[model samples]
Target: MIPTPEIRHVNVTRYITPLREGGSLPAVADADDGFKYVVKFKGAGHGVKMLIAELIGCEIGRVLGFKVPEVVFAHLDEAFGRTEADEEIQDLLKGSQGLNIGLHFLSGAINFDPVVTTIDAQLASEIVWFDAFMTNIDRTFRNTNMLMWHRELWLIDHGASLYFHHSFTNWEKGAQTPFALVKDHVLLPQASELDTANQKLKSLLTPQVLQDIVNLIPQEWLEWEGYEQTTEEIRAIYFQFLTARLAQAEVFTKTAQDARKALI
Candidate 1:
């Protein structure tokens, strides 16, 4: 289990708003540390799955040496003195208090846009490869979840990934392509350079490390359709795919490096 972080409380006002495309209520809370943070309510059933996935993903990303937001599980209470709007939304946010999740908000973060500074091809390619291994279909250009903060790319909003686990277990339907998500979704600018990205990914996808990481996720989270056996089988499938992909990544990485050396 990942160590939980300590949450602090302050007597300050918060502004709450509904996100355009997501299911959670996002609120901006003032911190004594003088920074405003974003906290999403975990009361809704839809938000619950997202909260769990984000927590696990952030930790894994950190282990993989990626820059992720400082996150903590928190509780918003009536004692903190909230706004009338917040109170109105409290019903929607009910049961989230004392167990809400907060992200130390990035003050000036911007969403990724291809028209903006281009993400490095090799780096982007690796991200796509990682998504494929995890079967994530939500990071498309139509709803790109990458955030540009301090000139680095940060991933966010993974509520839509691992969606196959939600449906009934009919192997034929499950194995079908177009897996309830568009396969040819727009790629990140660097995604086309898979040969280079695959190389890097191969080096990173060690079997032991991948197994350790996946095992860390709560068994409850892995279980699909409320069945533990199904969840275990699904995890095994991903593990096999990831292992093979890692080997491929190593080959690609070597080829790319050799090509680069030759050019130099």
Candidate 2:
């Protein structure tokens, strides 16, 4: 297996502000490492599973050369947010008093506007293929989950991807399943190079790489009360699911192409 990737770990020193735009209420805060990060608290919204999806999906995108923000583990202690006035925020902080996922905050980033931004055919196609591979359904125009910093596109908020894990029953079926919602993908109209991207990108996701990505999931996340399976089983399932998905890249890629065809 390829060596597991290393993500920076930092202690959250301050809760600067809550980003109300997201349902989970991730916050922008300063870490002990002298960097500001948008920390996704484990106690809010989708809980630990969302953090898992965010971690795994972001790493996969980064490996595929997407300009994703640097993800790190932001540690929150019991005393960190005690002084917050808002009841909801305080409750969220109390519940999330442990390990959480954080993305490096791009200081002056703006939202990506499909009508205004210029994207090439290859890049769009690659992004489509990537989303389809991950079974992501949140890249629609309504909420791009993307940002532009210094004229470069950066992907963010992948917590909505890999939705099958929410139930995780019959997960074997999920790996082979085609992503139909890709039709609503914001970049579908411009994704003319899907087939080419399929060929190039599939070769890069070796089994070792897949394992390394899956291995990045925190042990505590898997130990949640919601799951009936053992931690190892859960981890193996993620690895196997991704491996099967990569093996069936043609299935999902073709589905994306068909979706694109319907668009144009």
Which candidate gets the maximum lDDT versus the true structure? Answer: 2
Who wins the TM-score comparison?
A: 2
Over 1-264, each residue of candidate 1 has an lDDT whose tens digit, in order, gives: 333323354433464445546546566766555566676665655645565556545555555555667766555565543335556466655555545556677778998887776877666666665555445677877778778888888877655554544553543333333222334334433455766565555565466666765554444445445554676776665455445544444443444334334433
- Model 1 residue 63 CA deviation (Å) reads 3.0
Candidate 2 accuracy as lDDT: 0.91
Q: In model 1, what are the clashing residue pairs, if there are any?
A: 75-98, 199-253, 202-250
Count of backbone collisions within predicted model 2: 0
Please, what are the lDDT tens digits per residue for candidate 2 over residues 157-227? 99998887988898888888888889999989999999899998898798889888888888888886856
Error of 1 at 57 (Å): 2.2
Write down the lDDT of every candidate, Cα atoms only.
0.56, 0.91
Model 1 scores a TM of 0.65
TM-score of each: 0.65, 0.97
